[model samples]
Structures are given as structure tokens and as C-alpha cells.
Target: MVHGRKFISVLTLTVLVLGPGAWAGTETGMKGALADIPADVMGFVCVPSAKALDEKVNKLMQQLGLAQFMPTSLLTLVKEQTGVGDALDEAGSLALIVYEPASPSPDELHNAAVILLPTANAAQLLESLKAGEETDGVRPLSFFGRDQFAFSKGGHVYIGASKATLKKVAASEKDITSRLDPASLGHLQTLDLAVWVDAQKLVKLVKPFIDQLQEMAKAQAQGSGAGSFTAIQLRSMTRSINMLTEGLESAQIGVSLTPKGLGVSFLMATRAGTKMCELVEASPSTDKSLMVGLPADKFIVAGGQIMQAEATKESITDLDALFEAEELKQHCDVQQLGTIRDSIREMLLALRGASFSISALPESPEGLVGLTVVSKVVDGQKWMDNLAKVVAACKKVTQKEEVAKALELVKHEAGAATVEGTKVDRLSFDLAAFTEMEEKEVEEMKKVLGSDGVSVRLAAASPEHVVITFGGGEARMAEVLKLVKAGGSPLGEDAGIKKVSSSLPGKRYSEVYFAGDRLVALLSSIGKVTGNELPIRMAEVNAPVALVSSSQGPCCQVDVFVPMEMVVAIKDTVMQLMGAMMGGAKQTQDDTL
Candidate 1:
């Protein structure tokens, strides 16, 4: 795209130069000047030699009927005697002579001398000479002054002057002397004023010759065709000139010629001054959608920090050993396993060594215990495998006779077992159960007492009053309340039936019974008080059944149907219970009031 823009600028410059208005004045001047020379002299000037100049001048004189007066011998004699060579050597001193005579002269008497100057400034000299003012030997002459010499034949103007005046025409003579800078005019006298004037005329005649030479150049460029040779040659020559001057600085140019038109283009760098040009001859392509493309350089970078953090969090330790384990054979490629393991192990090690802390709730919510593990360097995969093994081992140990025996001994000493085990570390189940029951009692009290229909309304009616209502009235409510307050019945004592309270003012009654997973008390006034018989529907908890048979080597399946509603209720209840238990001490006023 950049190259194309440059090409158009060059083409536009060429068009401007060749337009109709260009060179108008120069063309007019060339035509007017050349018309004054005789046709034969014009023809000689077109040739490329000095010998042709003499031959053409002689022919022109004969054709003008001056052959009888100005004989060839006389012309030769005049040329030899005068020091005209020096005048011609000087810049812009050459001129043509025209003579007017009623009859021929014995000494070949001279006429007006028409000097040709290099530039327009010479026209002033010619004008001064015609005015005949002796001002520093320079004079101005008119274009028509040559007619006074009787040499204006065929509508061409001529100049006339005497031999004395010609000798005194020292302006050009002085110019020649200055240019040569000779100490004396001794042997150099042959190169005199007349000779100088003649040389200037000869040079003026050579103008048409130079034009013809340019024409020849045009012909060569166009292969001698008359068709637009000048324009073609101008374009070719200008292109060559531009290439020589511009293309040397890494500038490139191209030209194309086609049946329809010609095109040229150039490209240059803005910063380096380097350029390129191309010319293509084209008719518009038939396809309208052709596209051009330009290309440039671009740079980019890869890899960042966030990815490292994510990798660390998910990593496990001892991943290398897991890679070597046989159990992973079907799931992972053995060769790549080592690599995967190493990377994971390194990541785990990084995470473990990092100074960080994490807190997690115990797997069993009944235990108000939390598990906190500090970051530590451990084989991550091995740790995970060992954890699984510990769970399986612990489950087995829980049912083992040895573990039961140890628990029995502890219970004998402490009145309750509270064994703490390692591997699958846990406090004894009995102690855990007791702790759970106590927490549950506090939670249930908050729930029942905090409700607006219960605590608020009842407390408003009587601040210290007790509305002891249960599924089985005052007697059963009293026993259940006792069990809650004392944590559990004394370890070895047979919990005696007793009437702790009755709704009927001073009436008291009691009966003992075990009911529906809870111990209960019965009274005559309060029917079945202790056990509320919670509305629970039994749900079959399906455990995964791992089966191994010869046909199906190792397969596992689960037969289970979980009560979705129960699970949701359990989760909500546990959350509420936990909140209440944690806040219980602080919320005592809220509960009672």
C-alpha cells in the first residue's frame, strides 16, 4: 500500500511537465529564430560537422543570387586573413553576416554582423549596436537591422555594416581577448572581429542542428516511429534522469506500457530517504474485488503468575509413590505417571512448605470438635492413601473385641469410657454420645422456648410460671426434663420412678416405663409423659456392596434410597442446633424473658 502511493506521485509529476501549457515560449522563440536562416544553411546546421558548415554556407549564397558578388574563393580568403577563430572560442560571440550591395566590391567589403548570444541577454547587445551609440564599443541592434545589408531575401531580415564598422565591433573582440587572456595579439590576429561574428552566426545556425539531434534521440527511443516519439523520449529520458538521481538512494522505479495507457510508480521510505518506483501498464481488471495486502512486524509475550497459584492449591504430596502403585495401572500410563507424579509432588511440597492455615469442621457434626491442619511437607499422594487406609482400619477396629475390651477397662476406671485412638483419631463413642446429648438438650430448649406462641406469650402471661405440657402431661415431662438437666441417669443407679411435678395443683403421681428409644414416666393425671415418641419414619441406608466373583473380578454397587426431605430437615436442624448451642450462654435472658 505504501509503495502504490509513491508510484502515483511520480506519474503525476510527469503528466504536469508534458501538459499543453509547458514550454510555449521556448517553442515560439526556436521557430522565429530558425526561419531567418536560409533553408540550405538550416539543412547544414542539422548535420553534425564543421565541413558541412562551409559547404552549406556556400550553397546558401549561391541560391540567394550572391554567388557572382561573393565568390567561394573570396569567402575563403576573408576567412583565412581574419583572426575569427579566437572570437568563436569565446562564449556566445558567434554571429551570421548579411551583405547588401548595388554592385560587387574589389576588397569584398563587409555588411552588418548579427551576433548570437548564449541567453536572452545577447538581444540587448544587438539592440544597442543598431542604435549606433558608441558606448564602450557595445551597441544594440534591431531584429530588422539585417535588412539594411540587402540580405533579407525571401522575407528573412539581414544586417548591413561597413568593413570599418565591422573592424570597430570590438565588444565581442574584447570578450574573446578577456576569455583567452593573451599578453599580445601577435600571431593570434587571424582570429579577428569578422571571424568572431561568423562563429556566433554559425552557433546560432547550430540551434536547428541541436533540435534535429534531439529528434534523432526521440526516434531512437521510439524505434523510429513518427507516433508520439517526442513524448515517449521525454518520458524515457526523464525516467532515466530520475532513476540516476533518486533510485541511487534505495529508490526504485518501474514503467509499464499497455494498449490503453502507460503507468509509472516509485516508493521511498519516509525516514531513510530510500525509494522504489514501479510502472505498470494496465486496463482495469475485469475482477472488481481483487485485493492488495501490506505486512508489518509484531511482537508478543507468554506465561504468567495466576496459573501457579491454582496448581498449588490442587496439588497433593507423595504423588510419585502413587504413580508407582499397581492400582493406578489401568487409569494412568506408566511412563507418564512418573512425570505427572513428580510435578504433583513438587507442587504439593511447595504448598505444604508454604506458611498457611486451614480450619475444617469435624466430619461428624455431633462432635463440637474442629480439625485444624497446619501446612507441612508430607508426600501428598501417600497422605491421601494413608488416610483412606486409616478410615478402613478404624472402621474395623471399632468392631474389634480388643478395642471393646480396652474401652470396658477405661469405663471401669473413669465410670465412662473415653479412649482416644490414633490412625483414625477419635474420642470414644460413649463420651461423644454424652456430650452430644447435653448439646442437644440445650438446643431443643432454645427452639421450644424462643417461639412466639410459647416463650413470648407464656412469659408475658406469667414470668415465673411453667406450662408443663407434653405428649404425656406433667409426670412424663418432668422425667424427660430430669434426664436433660442431669445429662443422663447416674451411671450405675437404677433411675427410680418419681413424680417430679403435676399440672393439677398439689396432685402427685408417677410410674416408670422404657418407651420408643427413650425412658419415660407415667402418671394418672398426666397420661404418658416422658417419651414424646418422635415422628421418625425409618429409611434404609444403603452402603456400597463390593462384590468379587470370577466372572466379574472386582465390582461394586450401592442399593440405597435416601429420604431427601429427611436429609434437608436434618441439615437445617443441625445448623439451628449448632447456632443455639454456641450462643446458649449469651441468650439466657432471651430464653427466659
Candidate 2:
């Protein structure tokens, strides 16, 4: 799933992940079921087996603290409603889909469904449903042609929303599979778990709904639950989706358990002609660039590497057209639009490729947090010469008030640092220096202190290279130099990170590393704060949380590596606690009755 829109379909999805045991040790029959589904599905999720998952969940429930009676009661209700009690136990694969809902309010609501099992068991389940054929809302159904097909074909069954847009998938029969092929849906074989999404279909399906939301915003209703979607939020979301789907041609996601932890991967392909793909292709590999000049300490670090040329071009062009739309004319004037367009192009042209990082130092004297957005210029000192003029031209009218206060102070001053035998010049912008003179002096002081006093620290690693740090840190430059000297050995040399990076595309574009011990301690402290009796057992295990991505072909790969041993330990602790609670519950019941 694309993360955002997947959650947006909240009303339609109540997820239950299928287990792996069922998929293993057999040739899956899920393909037969998939054959009956339509092609142009908006959202789809298929899991290996319902039976194995149910077994685990039920055992956990039996051992756990929650009331057992409620689950049983709910199970009975579900059996009655869907008419498939134990049939789920025999399912080869289980899946759900959120497709086109009935008309009127597509943006906020959706319709969904799936009911199936293995061939032998599916017959029994079909019989159960047939027995309740006269049940209200369970009537004879038809697709594009009424009475043209039977509900059960072969050993599988078919059920869909009446208005389901399963566009004539019969022709693509040989190729009618979502990213998760039907035969393999129940099995990733050696892999522990998987998740996939049809990005093209998702984008295709949502575009119309976004347009409708735009129209609704014009009359902009007056309620909260349904029609209350504000234009600003809608516009922003629309733009975001448009931006995301811009270069994207296809997408896939997967989750698998490793010996130490778990690994999750998200992959997306850009259309051949998109600038994003080109940028990805041209991006530098972080593997060789060990020292990015970040702080050498135990901090939660996040960073990215982007080719400026493509990103800037796309952003400027897209945003320019977006604002140029007749609907957004009220927000800006011709002059402002023209200024923004030129600034963006110029900025991108100056920016060759940039890498930036954000970290929570927790224990550092310079500041509790640090942020750096450093862009490499085609000609650093030359660009520095015209920085004020170039940036000043880009400010829209709405932004004037924001920058007016900072405008009074000169933005740049010089400093230098030596990194690995190279002397680097840095331009430091300490906006906090102007805090006392700011109109709202007292308030401005608080804001600056909170925001590291609005400091922008840039280190010119070389004539062509520049590192920009955005917050407070007296030793920030020291950290930057150390980062360059260390060359990010903490991540590049990490075994787990290396493993994950290898699985992804070979061209590493970006990397992030998290201290496992610190994170675990943080979690344990949080539990203590909330008075949670069960402390997370993470401290007992040490593993780095690493994410690295690489560009390959027209697409890129992002892999998240986390230790499975920690996950397993947590599971064991939870189940043990649940068993204790269940025993206590039983004693209480006996005492009561």
C-alpha cells in the first residue's frame, strides 16, 4: 500500500494479516479464486492463509487477558452474518479489496469484500451460504451481464459489490494477477510475509475522487463527519498525491521475518520519461562516501541524498501549473507566480545534488536536536556571491511577513573547519543574533531558543561542496567535520545494514541508522511513565535499525531492517503475560460464580 491512501480507506478496511504456515507445505489453490476477480481493482491485499493466522490468534486469545466470552460471542455473530464458521480454517488464501463504492461520496467512503477458502472447504462454505440464500441482502447476483454467470465456479466462489468496477478481466485471464500473483499469493516460500499494492490502479481510482472533493470544496459544506472536508486540506492532499504519483509507474511492498528481526521493503518504478527516474539514475552512491560529516555519537540519525536537477525541475513545473489553475488564482498574483517559477529553476540549477540529515542529540551541549540541509552547488563561492539576490527574488507575498523580521539582519558570516586534510569554509547564519532587535523581542527569543535560534550553518567541504546545518550546536561544525572524517562508518560497516542494502538495488542513494539500545531504553522509559507493568525487553537485545535505498533501472528500492529476535522476545513476553492474566481471570470467575 502507498501508506497514506491505504489509511484513507479506513472506513472500508478492518485488516487481519494471514499467517504463513498454511502457505507453506502445499501448492496454493488461491490462483483459482483470483481467476474469478476483476482486473482493475483499486486496492487489494492477499495473504497466505487464514487458518494458520486464526490458530495463532485463537491460542493467544486463550492465553491472554481479554474476556474470552466476548470473542466467542463475536465469532458466533460473524458465523451467522457470513455463514462461514470453520470454513475459514480451510482457506488457502485470504484477501480483501476496497474498490469503487456506490456513487455520491467516493472520497470519504468505500465498499469492500472477499469470502473464500480452499477448494474442498470452499464447497462446504458455499453450502453454508446457500442455506442462507433467502437471507436479506444475500440474493442472486450478476456482473456486467445479469444471470450470465454462476456464483461458484469450479471449487471457488465469487462475491462483489453490485456496482463493483471489476472491468472485464476475462480477456487478461492469463495475465490477470495483481502484483501478488494468485499462485504465489498464499506463498512467498522462503519469505515469512508479504504485502503488495497496484499503484497504477490506486492512482487511477483516486484521481476522480480528488476532483470531486475539489468541487465539493467550492460549495464547501458546513458539517464535520461527512461533507466537512476543507479545501486547504483537500488541495494539499491532492497536490501531495499528484506529486507522489508523478514519476511513479508501479509500486510494491513486502514484509518478511529474519533470524534477528524483520525486514520491510517498498519499491516503486518511475515512468521512463519522468525526471524523478533520471534523477535517481544520476544520484550518487552513499556506499563509497563513508563520512557525510555528521556528529560522531549515539544519536537517532536520518538523512537523504537527492539529485537536485530533476527534483527541482519537477517541483517547480508541477507547482507552477498547479497554482496556475483557474481555481487557485485567488491565492496569488501573476508577479508572485513568475518570481516563484524563476527562483525554483535557478535554485535547482545551482544545486547539483544535496544530502541533509536530522538527529536528536539528547545529551549534546550544542543542542538537543540538530538539522542540516546541505546542497552542493555547481560553483559554491559564485553561488554564495548571489545568494541574497537569488533567494530574495523567490519570496511570494504571503512569505514577506515571515521573512521581514530576518531581513533586517545580514544573513551570512564566515567560519572554517578542516576535514581530512581539506580546509573547508563555512558561512554561518545566526538569526538568533537578531532576536533582541526583533519587533516581538521576548517572543522572538523563545522561538529562536526553541528553534536553535534560527541558525543556518553551511560548511564548504571544498570549492564545489557545501554542508548546511539548520539549528544550534556550538560543536556542530566539529560534528560535521567528524562526520566527513568518519565517512559514516557506523552505518556503512554495520552487518545488518549491509545485509539489507544488498537485498535492495545496488546503487545506494540514501542511508539511515538508529541506535537500538537507546531506542529500547526510550521505549522502556515510556512504559514506566505510563505505569505499564510489562517493560519492553529491547534492552536485552542490541541491533541497529537501518534503512537504505538504491536506484535501479527506472525504479528504486527502500529496505527497512529490524531485528526479529527482539520481535520474538517481545512476543514471548506478551504471551506469558497474557497467560498469567488469563489464569487470574479464571480464578476471579470461579470466585464470582
Candidate 3:
């Protein structure tokens, strides 16, 4: 039986996956259940077997060293709520199929969704219904907060919004399961949970909602000229929304738990020959070498390829129009702004990829955080030229009192420096220069950073790339440029990083790598300083965390991989915290006595 809470959860999952499975195996009635699904469904949610999933989760919990903290059995709760017996044990799979209107009616939509439950004993299941009456071969019942129809046939029980829906599914002779991708089905067969959707059909079903949104936007812009900045921006956004919906062909999501780790993957495929598909096709793969020149000990490293030229150019034109608008034109110099815009466009057009690295977090609020950013460009000279223009334009605006103060600080605190034959721009400042703080607090910050001033540097890493350095000073800048000159392998080529990356899809538009071991250590140190030690003491594990987004054929895939060691640490930490809380409560009771 489908309860309201559970039904709503299924529906929520369907939507979350939009932007974004086990049976107790056996020949179990899965085949018959699939055969009864309506062929023209807008979408369907499938659970291979609730019992199988429960077993797999319990086993995984045990594998992660969480057996002592296992929760109550899921099936027991289901039986308590539905008043169904062993009949559920024989139920191999559950499916809820969403369909278009059966027939248009003036009163309300005739649209419906049907739930198919495969059970060998239909009589036992029927007896558990709270209130129902037989009508023809179907039973009319109140389920999921509404009047619904239910019937049993061919080792399965079908329930839906109306008898018409039940009839279509029960009479389905076309193998509806054939519509799904074979790969998705194969994955579902082995995973604990999964969902697949016919994206095109879903778009048709949700078109009314999209249309309403567009109408609302038009209403908001009622009196504005079509050529107005707000109106043009609105139109552009609407086009993007339509393209996203119309371009998608299919989508599937899967969740799995194993000794390696727990994994959730979402894949979305665009229709062939669509503009969205073309955009993805034009995206370049992430260059792993972009990680070079970044310090090897950074806690986080992230990089991605830039969008195609057409999109960038369109964005620049929109900015120009925005600056020219009457409302904005009165604020500042339009001509200088145009120069800044052109320089920006030049820089963006030459960019291929960029990467950023955070070496360390500040120990205190006043402490300086250290980091570096590098951009791979086709023409480094153009990047440098544009950067100078931007600086000059910014200087012109400093005539204002507040602006002049900031400009003076920049000129006083930073300037050009020679590091290993390369002219690098460096900036160094103390918290006192920017904010009012107690002298002792300022001293503490300086002590933590090992200097009275925090510094950053900028330099051309190569003929094709430029680099920016923060906090590490000349030594760090020299080291970074040395790596560029050496053309050495990036830290990602290390064994730990390679292991994590290899587990994810290889053709990525973007990727992020995390040093979990260093992160945990940092957190532990922070906890000790704050006098809040964690209950469970964990040793640093050698696994790295990775998130990668890539394209496989027409499908867009985003995968996040967290190593099993991290999972174990998290589980142990949670269990220990609960135990400590319980112990504290007992101690409090004794004290009251």
C-alpha cells in the first residue's frame, strides 16, 4: 500500500533528480510487474525490492563498522503502517508510473499516476485495505488523500487515480520496459536504488507549468519596452529554460553502497542535433596538467574549462547594453567602462582553462588565508595587456575620497618585485591597514602568520598561461615559476589522486580534488585549540575526494567519489557522539539525585 509520506518522498526524489534496486533477487515477479506498466508513461519510479534494499543497507552499515548502531528493520515499519503480512515478502518490486490525461474533462485534469505492486497473494494484500468496495473487477478506496482505484491481476496489484488508469496498465501488451536504456536497467539490477525518466515525455507533461512561469514574467514586464534591458534579459532567460527542457532526451540516477564507498551518480542526455548538445560538444576536456605549479600540499584543488566563444561574446554584448541603459549611464563614465568591457572580452576569449588552490585556512579571523590561482590562455600577452587596461580604468575612479584611500593603500602596500628573473606583482598588508582591532589581537594575527604583513604575487607562468600567488611571498612565487619552466607532472599524477580520479568518468569539463587526510588533521588541530575535542580520534587516511562532471556521448554525467575510509571515519564519529550524549544524560540524572 502507498502511504502519503512515502508517496511524497518518491515524488520529491523524482524532482531533485530532474536538475540532477535490489530485490531479494530471484526470478521474483519483477518481469510481470514491468509487463503491466503503461507504455506511454511520462515517468516511473522503481524499487527493485524494498526487502532487498533493506538487507543491502544493513550489510553495508556493518561493513562500515556501524553494525552496533543499526536501526529497526524497514520492512517491520512498513508492515506496521500498511497492516500487510508475509505477502509483502513475496513482493519483488514496486513501481509508480505517471501518465498524461486519460481523457480531458472540464472539471479537472484526468491525468493520473499508477502504483504497481507485485505480490503472489493478492487476496491477503486486499484484506488489509482500511476501507474499500468492489466495483466490477476493481476496488474503490481512499488512498494517498484521494479516491483511487485498485485491482489485482497476474500476480500483481495495480492502484491508481482512476479505474481508467488501472485498465490501461493491466491491459498493456507492449513491453513498456523496453523503452528504458539497457545500461540503466543493468545498473538497476545490481544497485540498491535507482530511478529512470523519459525526459521528452516529462517535458510534455510539465509544459503547462513552464508556460505559467513565462506568463508571470511577461506580466511583471507589462509596461517595459521589449528593447529594455530587463525585458531582453527576461527573454534570454526564458529561452534558456525552454532549451533545457526541450533539449533533454533521457535521464537516470543510481545509488550504490559497497566496501569502496557509497556512490550517487546522475546522468542526463541531450537530444541529438539540439543547440544544448552542440554546446556540450564544443566544450574541451579538463587538462590534468593545469594542476601543475600549484603547491602539492593544498587542501583543495579545483579547475575547469571555460565555456565556448559564442556564449562569452553574447554575454559581453549584454553587458554593453546594460552600461548604455539610461538608469546606469548617469552613474559613471561610459567610455572608460567600455574600455574595461573590451579588455574583459579579450581576456575571456583567450582563456582555455583555470585552476585554483587553497594552501591553508586562516587559524583565526584576523589571520591571512593563503592561496593561488592560474589561468591557461592561448595568448598570454593579450591577458597581460587587458589586465593593464583594467588597472588603469580602476585608477581613474580613485579620485573620489573613499576610492582614493583604497588606491593609496594598494600603492603603498604592493608593487613590482623580481623573483627568479620574472617580474611579479606583489601585495602585502596587515589587518591594521583595513580594519580597527585591538593592538594585541593584531599582534596575535601577525604571530600566527609568522609575519606582520600578509602578501600575494602575480606573474606570467608561461607564454600561454599566467599565475597569481597569495601569502607565500617570493619563495613561493619562484617555486611556482620553476614548475612552469620544468614542465613537470602535476600532483594529480600521484598514486592517491590517480586512484580517485580513475574511479570517475574521464572526459570531464570540470574536476575537483581534495586532500581528505590534510583536511581531517586541520580540523582536529582546530578542535584542540577550541577545547572541543571529538570523541573519536581518527588517524589520517590516504584517500583523496574527487568530483568530476563529464559528457559521454549525448549524456552529461556528474559523479562524486568519497573513499570508504572517509565513510568509516564519519560513521565512527557520529556513533561516538551519540554515545557521549547518552552518557552525559545519565551523569546528569545521577547528579540530580
Candidate 4:
């Protein structure tokens, strides 16, 4: 009654209302609908059989210990809203595609996705949406091929960024799949959760954006619009950007389920001749050193080549031109070094490739934490000698005031400790004694130092290793010896761990291993503390994941393995815990009212 095209509106409505029944045909007609999808796709996530995926999810839910807590009603609502009904059992291949834009937008780029379904389900998908206000906006029947129409058959629902992309794809004789770069698709074919990115193509796509941000960061650093910031900070950001830009060519990774755990095998390539390339080439093959003397009760452990040391030295050319005394100023107090760069440089000279770990002292439990650091050296004796010279030199000049300030609370004294019948330099701090000092006296020291107090016990654990204890009571030979003896039963001796370690190529550079039993017990204990009992105990599902980082050819790879069942159990426990916490919080508020 109102518009210029009332008849057209009526005609459009009739087509949608009347055409659906004819299109809904038999489910059998939906077969092979997935293959019809246009291959030329920027990105696509395919569900070959929704029924299979749904059933698997249901089976997994049943296997979960706290299946009762799952919100089934919510899932049912989602299925109804998404327009994929239980008829999915009869529905064949469904793919959602993200088509690349013909040109990039300067602001708020719009995109489109085409939801591909079986020809039979297109009508059902649209009809399912009719129950709500969703269908009210339908522009259907005005455009399939002639009048820039709103709807089309051949199994696709246009939405958001995919609207135009689908229209273009509809006219093409060949699809993206047929025309895609073989290099990209072949790499993806090798992986379960496959991803293939052409490094050069990605660089072109993203680097300009990064360059603009870098310039902005530099400009902000030069000005004061961003509040408290420094040129040094801006410079650091630039370095980070450079680091991000380095060594990326192509990467391929695969994920698969295994009896041992969820296994991931990945391959990443880095540009040649770059600093990262050199570092990767120099990196040792294994991370065994990190766990060399590790104990099962440890929390965090790490090991890797001393890339920083090399980088520090490499920052300056003609290294020998700078004498020992000049180099001393490079890595200590800014006031002491004259320049921060100098301080960083000197510190680098004494550091090298090493491995280390932190663990609770068996006797003191969590109260006492111990750290063991081991360094690789051609000659342990010579390495210690050079290190001693560096430390002694650092003490005599420029860097001492900074050291004194740092250890002001801890009365600093030089001593020697014998470990394995060898004399090694030692430093001790007694927190108990430090706290007893007069407030006035402490304040006076802090003026020259800082308004903070920290005490640590340090020892040269061995010629090639050092032990630094934050809370472990005795910092002497006996304690250090206990740590040096990486505990038995687990750690270096566990059969499963050893097997995984052995499988990695090259000498071990670094690794992170979680003891299955220990990790399970620790996590389960949290439930007990909160008085929220889990339906099942972690001990029943003993699965361990090992993260091994090592170098392979021109790339670096980290392989991780954990069991699927273990993953499910962990997820269930966490959800239950969160639910309990939320419920308790709500109850507290209710009681307050």
C-alpha cells in the first residue's frame, strides 16, 4: 500500500514462500553437495560429515567424568539457530569459505563468507531461520543471476563478508581448489590441522602495516604524547620488530592423536644468512642439560645456547680493539658503565650456553626453592678462571656501587666453599639476620641502595655449574651436592622421557617435561583445597606431555605429545572447578543481601 514496487515485493515473497517446498527435496539428493564448492577459496573450513563430528563429540562427553554438568539445552538451542538440524546425518559435505577481496580497504574492510551446503539443505537452512526475526530481512529471489538478486541455489548461503565473494564464485567455471598453488596445498595435505602460508606473500600482505606501526612507535618515542617513555624503549621496540621480521619462509605443522599423547610434528623455515639462521644453526640438538640433575618435584626448568652472549659480542665489530678495561664499563651500572650499551656488552662476555632448573628442597617442601645452572665449556677449569677474572674486575671498578646497592640488605662477604674437593667462590645472605638490623640503619643503607630488601645464597655448584638458592636453608656443599645429584626414579632416568629424548636428532639443547603423576597430583590437590571434589582422580589417567625444542636442518621445531583422554579429563576438571567457584561467589552475594 505504500511503495512504488508493491507488486514486486509480493512476487518476491511468493517465490521464497512457495519455492522452499520444491527445493527441500529428499535428503538423498544432498549427496556430493560438498564437492560442488568453488575451489578458489582464500580459506575454508570443511565438515565432510557433521553427523560424524557430532557423534564423536557426544561420545567424548559421555566419557567425561562430570558429564552431568554439561549444558545440553544450550547446545540444542545453538543447533537450531545455526540452521543445521539433526538432518545433518543425511547431509553431506558442508564448507564455509572466506574469499579474498579483489582489493584491500583503507578503513573497516568488509568481508564475506559463503556457507556451502547440499542443494537439499539450502532451503532447510533458510526455513529454519524463519522461526525468528532473522527471515524478516531476507532479500531473497531478487538476484540469483539477473537483477543483483539476494538468493541462489546450487547449495550456498551468502552471509557477511562472503556475499559478494560467493556471487563472483558462482560465475566462475573453475574453483579456488583447482587453481590454488600446489606448494601451499601440498604442505597442508601433510598435516591434520594443516596451515600453509607463503612467507613471501604474507610479508607483502602484512609488512606494510607493520612498517606503519613501527614509524608510529618511533614518532611517539620522539615526542611525549604517549606519557612516560624513553628513546631507549622506542629503540627496544624497533629491535623487537626487527626480530619479528627475521627468518620466516614457510612452515608446516601436523597434529595427530597417539597412544603416548596428542603428538604435533612441525617444520618451520627461516630466511638464510640472517642472525636467526646463524643462531638456529649453532643451537645444540638436545635440551638434556636442563634436566641433567633435575628432580621430579621441580616446577620450572629451561636450557638453551647462550645466543645472547654471542649477540652481545657481535653488536660491536673489531672486538679485540676494545681493551678489557673499556669492555668492563659496558655491562654494569649505567653510572658505572658510562653507557648502558657498555654494561650489556661486558655482561655478555661472561655468559655462555647453559641449562638450569628450579625445584623445591625435599626437606623444606615448598618453603625452600633451589636453582641449578650448568654451562657448557671446553675446559671447566679455564672457563672458571676467565669468569673469576671478569667478576674480580667488575668488583674493583665502575660496577661495584650497583652491586652494593642491590645486596644492601644482605650483608655481602666473599668466601670459598669446597665442592667435590674443588675450591669455588661463594656468596651468602642471611635474611634472618638482615631483618634484625635497626630501622634507622636500614633506611640509611637504603638511601644509598634501595627501599627494598632481598637476600640470596649463591655457590659455584661445580666448575661447570652454579647453584643459586632463594630459600633453600643451607647454601653450602651438602645442599648443592643434593641438587647436583638430579634425583633418581624420574628426571633423567624415566624410561618414557628417555625414549622421547633419544628420538630427537642432535645433542640436546633444551626441553620441558611434565611428570605425569606429579603434575596430576598437584592439580588434583587444588580441588581438595577448595573442598570441591572431582568425580574422578587424576591418578587414574596417567598421561604425560613432553615439549622438546630442537633444531632440524634450516628450521627449529618443538614437538609436544599428550594423550587425548588426558586433555578431556583436564578440561572437565577445570570446568567443574570454575562452576563451583562461580556458584560460591553468587551465594556469598546473596547472603550479604
Which candidate leads in TM-score?
3
RMSD of each: 49.8, 9.7, 5.6, 10.6
Task: Report the lDDT of model 2 for residue 320.
Answer: 51
Q: Please, what are the lDDT tens digits per residue for candidate 3 over residues 1-593?
A: 34445445324322322211222333333444455566677666666566666676667656766657655655565555445566654336666676665332311132366666567778777766543778866887655445667888775677766677677776776655676555344434544445667887766766787889999888765657655667767777887787789788878776655556656677776777987777655666654544755656545444434456765665666665665554444444667777777787788878767777765544544233457677778876668767877666665643567655664555322238777787776555545676766776566556445352565677776788787876555666787788766765465565566777656666677777776556656556545654555555555565667777776556667777787777677667677778889999999999999
- Kindly report which residue pairs in candidate 3 clash with one another: 21-192, 21-193
> In angstroms, how far off is 66's CA in candidate 1?
25
Ranking by TM-score: 3, 4, 2, 1
Give lDDT tens digits, candidate 4, residues 318-376.
23223223234354443423333343344345555554545434332223334555554
TM-scores vs. true structure, each candidate: 0.13, 0.60, 0.78, 0.60
lDDT (Cα, 0-100) at 157 in candidate 1: 21
Which ranges in model 4 have alpha carbons more than 4 Å from their true place? 1-52, 66-192, 195-208, 224-229, 250-268, 271-284, 287-290, 295-335, 338-352, 364-367, 378-406, 410-415, 430-490, 495-509, 514-546, 559-593
Native-vs-model 3 lDDT? Answer: 0.62
Q: What is the Å distance of residue 257 in model 4 from its true position?
A: 5.5
Assess each prediction's global lDDT (C-alpha) against the native. Answer: 0.26, 0.49, 0.62, 0.46
The prediction achieving the highest lDDT against the true structure is 3
The per-candidate count of clashes, in order, stands at: 54, 12, 2, 30
lDDT score, candidate 1: 0.26
